[model samples]
Target: MEHLFGVMLVWLLAAVWIFLLVSWAITGDVSAVEAAFGSVVALLLAIASAQRAFPYVVPFSLATLGGGAVALPVLRAYLNRAAHAQMDAELIERACLAYEFDPKNYGALINLAEVCYKNGLLEQAVRHLEHAIQQAPVMAANEKRRLRMWQDELQHHPKLGYTPCMHCGARSSVGAVRCERCRHLLLPLLVHGRWVPRQLVHKAVAVWGIAVGASALSLLWREQLTGLNALVAILATLSVALGLIVWVVRR
Candidate 1:
């Protein structure tokens, strides 16, 4: 409901901006300064409304802008993958919530575990898998075997911080800085408290590349571009860049 209201408000502000712009363009009576001011105010209002209505879009767009010097296709593929991951997470969460209404739904628990594993929530995934395994006796023999196999694999998965020692190939305990078998220093895997994935930082670099490239092209063809066209390009680029920053912080 709130999202719908925000979208409607944005459209209203956008319509007003268009009317003011058109009126100024056609009427010689309206001062350029006054028209520009009104346009700026309307644009800001519209952007605010958009943020409220489509919060994720803004951040994703901005992160794309920040992806400086990255190839367009690569950056796009990364974002697409991340978006899919997020969608899967949401779906799994919804399924888990639904399963809560019926605690006997072992399938939902397994699905939730798989999704959590893919999303790097290793500990949570392990817990879900264990729960599903406990409920496995009621399931078929093959199903029990499959669940056990998954649980075994997850128990040794490196992302859970139980990585193999470089020197002796023995697995180290979680948060272990050294290999217990060989006394070798293990590689540190630090998981920071980040709202957004580190991948967003890489995407932001590509975005910066696009912004710079566009600006350079505009400057090179300045004689072919009008003042309004140049202004629009600048504003569009800035908006995208800003949106990526918003996504990074909010995510």
Candidate 2:
């Protein structure tokens, strides 16, 4: 029975590792260090399997401890790399998508332009912003204000050069809210012209809440954990909740 229990425990650990591995593949959440840690864990598991399958000279407990120590670092590196890769991919996608603006929807154009600007595609952003401003009315105060804002923003950051709108041939400020020549009101529909999908934010919050709830439950009812572990769990739960609240407010 004791031997059976030990084997079951090893299988359970392997299952958890498998779940993490799948999650890493889906989300790219693990870094190079974490990948290395996972490899180490696999190595240790192999050693343990060998020892269990065939009688080994080394003590079982020592082997298990050594396996754990080697696996931890590998996991850390893998997680870091995965997370970085995911972020890079998202950024690249956002940059590419920012240039696909609808001409009639000046608000969306401005939003896309702003996203492009933030992503370091400043020239493209400026061009889009100029187009939006040109479509605005010349006498509209709001449009003029927006144009001025963009112009001032570009002035301070000269990499985003002034480009006269092809439609109106106006040398308008990016900061101008309206076209000086045509008086088009260039009102932005979204905040800073960036399209933040509410769905993504909601999903992030939901995941954060679930993780926090799990952590709280683990800390509250877990007798297996040491006092320090319990405290850490509680703190992590609180931190996750706090972070979620902050993100929601900011978004």
Q: Residue-wise lDDT of candidate 1 within 25-105, one digit each (tens)?
A: 466333465446445544544564465422343333233322311343354455566557667756675655656666657
Candidate 1 local distance difference test against the native: 0.53
- Candidate 2, residues 1-251: lDDT per residue as tens digits? 66655655565555555456556646655444444444455445544544463333123423443454455346446445444444543553343344233345566556656655655445556666667677665634665676577667767775624434434656556544344676543222112223334344434434443443444345343444567786787677677666766665666
Best by TM-score: 1
Measured against the true structure, the TM-scores of the candidates, in listed sequence, are: 0.39, 0.30
Q: Lowest lDDT 10-mer window, candidate 2?
A: 185-194
TM-score for candidate 2: 0.30
Q: For each candidate, what is the lDDT? A: 0.53, 0.50
lDDT of 2: 0.50
lDDT over C-alpha atoms for residue 214 of model 2 = 43
